[model samples]
Target: MATKTAARASVESNRNDDDEPESIPAPGAKRHHFLDPRRATGRLFVATAVGIVATCFAPVHLDWRIRAVLGWDTGALCLLVLAWNILVRSCPNETQRRAGAEDPGRNLIWAVTVLASLFSLFAAVFVLRKVRAWTGFEGQLWTGLALLAVVLSWLVTHTLYTFRYAHLYYRGGRADGLDFPKDQKPADIDFAYFAFTIGMCFQVSDVVVSCTRVRRAVLVHSLISFVYNTTILSLALNVAFNLLGDG
Candidate 1:
């Protein structure tokens, strides 16, 4: 009986984890119907992720570069989905306590976030410079305005979510110990801070370039500004989608 019980629990856990955020039915609910909007949106996210992976690598004979817009979009969408999953789902009551009682997944998530932010700054200064050479800004005023709007929106979303999460946490935590309706993971805060960092760096670089007469320094400033602005542009559309969600 114990073995059968364990086996059943394992199956249930797998089923829960396998279902998409939008596709998961409410408790005691019947199976979802075909043409379900929620299921389709869930599938859409999966397909977007698959597209990112496929486009990132080219056939041996082909020379195609990764699509920056698609990649950044998938990333931002994945964050919202993750936030939804953790916020809305339930965890098993009887988790096997690890030695030292550490949450490895939480640690890894934060570490990767910090590292990604750091890398964004460095990559802005060098890796994306080549991209700018290919697609020059060309004084597109509308494009510049759009990019600034994106950064501002990200900042607002991040701040609001962080505040809400903190309130939930301080209220003796939630039933599942970490989740609450409409609450987000700490990683969102890190990403928000990352977006803010990118914006500040871009503005500072602009000022430095305008004030300095050094040609080399100006070139470097241009690279930083271009990369920071482009990252914001790449991520803006998908990040905007979060504001439209119910959670």
Candidate 2:
């Protein structure tokens, strides 16, 4: 009877084990999406806001002496944004050859942005020189030169990156996607692009000043950029109004 009971218990344990579900691995962990438009826009807004606040509270006047200096600084900022954009947009073969070179589309976007930045920098310098001449600010010559040097350095760095990435893209031997379409009227596009580029320049300068760990310089430079740009925009609007009114 004891032997019979043991055999029955063994049979019951075997049945229970057979009835249990087999373990299956969970679906491969979902990948986290890092780039979202909403997040990017939010970051841009925050950066712009911080820059504006720093400019407003800081005591700095947009005097003729400082106009050239501010112009150069703003130009540099525009250049950086353009370069950043290009870096995102460009798709190069070398980029894919390296580890973790996913998302060619984004790479292309960065490349375009960088190209735009270079153009904007050139435009800013041209515009600033005109502004300086118009305003008759001779004292800021040294400052202007310094700004030019910074811009030149940026251009050199950017050119090297551009050539390397472009070569990779051309040589990679990949199928081309839909080309980037140009939208908006030429004049309107130019104005909007320059305005936004200049705005970014102010924001970049603010970051630099803050990073220097000098609170006062940051505040002062921020204010200078804000006031100068404001004045410039106002003047530009006035000119447009007069031209349109005459037309």
Candidate 3:
């Protein structure tokens, strides 16, 4: 009887030890997920940019067809990314593994996103200024490209920050992290809603950020969104006025 009890205790101990490693994942493990911003958003952005660049070189007669293909591909990929996010959220096991894990690629992700944002701004301004000299269909094409670039840049920026907020929330745990309205921890989509609100409204909407670290992240995100949204709105107005003048 004594021997059997000791044996059972030993088995349970080993089982607990095996499960311990899952709690704190190995470095870079988080990036392997399909929904990781680096893997999902990064791939989508690259594909869209490639399609746009390819469309630029296409002959005038084929330009519309190329643009049509680009639009279809971009829209499809965006849907896939969103669907995958919702699927992962529905799976408790996957969400458990993702939560509270360190993201080793964060610095690289931030660097790339910031560079893209700056480039988008510069390109939009440049296109607006140069469109007057382009004339007719060429100017319209250039303007369209700038709009696409700006939209892509805006999407990529918010997407990256959305995941960044999730990571920080999980890493900080319930005690020192974001305070969602009801749930102890919210889904990635919830974070997406939070991020887009900040991007559009420059405010925190429903979620209450609880810690300094997250507050700092929110501040930076708000500032970037402010600049990006303001610039895009101004460019639209200017472009509208230009079209009116041309008319």
Candidate 4:
């Protein structure tokens, strides 16, 4: 009877082990359906496309207030989607955690990054063209709004990069690469701090990066920020010249 009980226990343990899911789910397996990263990326992409079209082709005579409202709403929506992607959808499905190379949403995020960069580029061009034809108080208001829009676009791009960094860190089991304070695993907000510091200062502030991929990401982010800041500076000079001419 004792031997039989021992055999039964062994069989139960084996059954439990067999019931456990894999550390990485195979491709095409059903995973988390809530706030799926792919779906979120698609939403952000469509919203950005709409914003770009509106900024480029909207009626030239549209009221400034209406344009401001639309721009603000669009910027806010893009930001919201990105934040959601970072907070809720940043992690891979349970089974994919060990399959580090199979991160499902990275490519989509890259597409968003490219499109976001275009949005800011178009915004800068729009401001440059629109400023040339207007002067005085109306000119100042348009210039201010245009600058704000460009800044907003820059913010969106950096925020997306923040999410990208977070995805990379966590996908690697939060093990190496970035060394956070107290040797703790970094969270989404920590990644934001890291990414924005690069955007603002064009260099890493406190965190130490030992991973090659993260360093590459930081390099790309800094380059983009530098370009964006230079564009804003040029816009400022253009606005100053236009206003002086009006005076």
Candidate 5:
């Protein structure tokens, strides 16, 4: 009977060591989730920018038709990204694993995202021609500029996700080590993260503007961007905390 009991204990120990993907942590283990600015904006920027391009380039007779086919009207894709950030929240062990090896692949993701943001910004400018011709608004040029910047607003929503990813995955991890002190004069983190922050700001602003234009309503856009902008501000504060914590 004692032998059987010992065997059972050993089996349970081994089983506990195996990784259970998508499973919640066992009882008594605490998990921490932080607000990430990057994540909040990531989905908003990527999806909105992509949606705009589709709207401009699709063979459909009208831009609205393209939006219909892409299902871009409801911001479904951005919402999925927001959900993904929640799902990928890390436990302590997973956080440690992220610190062990750098994922170079993320560099490509950042680069592509940055370029896409720029292209969308320019495209918004190019579309000014149409807005001026179509609308008798008093300030057509200014409105076009503002609308061009809406994707940045939309992207701002996910900056929380991005910054949280940085906190959990990069704080004392690989990129954290490369980052400059946030407190020091002209201080900064890794170039990739730095670029990511700047790009996200623009991306988010673009989204906010774009969505507001699409809905022609401020209540939803304002409420959402308000949440996202708060995250972006928090991310700035976190960069300082991360630097201090690492020290």
Candidate 6:
């Protein structure tokens, strides 16, 4: 009887131990929230400034007149994208926060986009020479080819980023990286959705502009803008569509 009582006591003690709550980290020991809108905006501002300077200094064989016009366009587009990203970071929704946590997959897409832009630029330069040679440059096949290349390049870059954003949302629940807090109000969600749609419209405009340009510098600038704009727009549209459909 004593042995049985001892065994029962031991089992009871073990059960009690198992039922005890595990030690959680102290509140003070927990990491503080690292995300800050001001810092993100600062980074974006620096990036935009750097792009403007780089575009200004980037050597090209084009005429001074062409350079001035296209350089401004390029710089403006880069700045716009940087600002857009900053805005995204500043007011990130849950989907955005999740997407931000993932690898951006920028390398391959950037390379392809750059290559396509370069090709379009060269084609534009070549077209100028052709225009000088031929009386009517409107019906030339090369013009069509140049536009096609720019569009394709922009499309490829846009697609890569769109896929990455989708992956991030799937993994983290935000498209841009701002995770909606547990107690976030419905109005905040609606605002984020609206911002996303506006961002997407900017992207579509970029593509449209890139394909219509006839100058090398103009084409390149348009292509770059198109890539940025398309990615932002597509992601936003996808989220909006899904949310509406769910409702």
Candidate number of the best TM-score: 3
TM-score (C-alpha, index-matched) for candidate 5: 0.33
lDDT of 6 by residue, 1-247 (tens): 9999999999986663333222232222222233322232333345346546755775576444334434434533453454345334443343334333433344544554565456445544444444434333442433344334344444434433443333323333322222334534222233334233333443222111111111222333345565655543343344335434444
**Candidate 1's TM-score:** 0.29
Candidate 6 versus the native: TM-score?
Answer: 0.31
What local distance difference test score does each model get? 0.35, 0.36, 0.61, 0.61, 0.38, 0.39
Candidate 2 at 175: error in angstroms?
11
Ranking by lDDT: 3, 4, 6, 5, 2, 1
lDDT of 5 by residue, 59-106 (tens): 565455223334342343454455345435644344334322222233
In angstroms, how far off is 56's CA in candidate 3? 9.9
Q: Write the per-residue lDDT of candidate 4 for residues 1-247, one digit (tens) a residue.
A: 9999999999986663333222343444444443443434444656656566665565678765447435654654666665555454443343134223234254665665666556555655666677778766877766676666666766766777765675455553334567887876565567778988998889998899877667777887888788767766577567667667767
List the lowest-lDDT window of 10 residues for candidate 4. Answer: 95-104
TM-score of each: 0.29, 0.25, 0.65, 0.63, 0.33, 0.31
**Residue-pair clash count for candidate 6:** 19
Score candidate 5 by lDDT.
0.38
True lDDT of residue 80, candidate 3: 43
In model 1, the worst 10-residue window by lDDT is 93-102
List model 2 lDDT by residue over 1-247, tens digit each. Answer: 9999999999986663333222221233122233421122232344334434544443466454344334434444544464445444533322223212222232443443344344334434444445434433442344344345344433423333333222222222321111213422122122223223334364332112112212322233345345544643444444435434444
Model 4 clash count equals 2
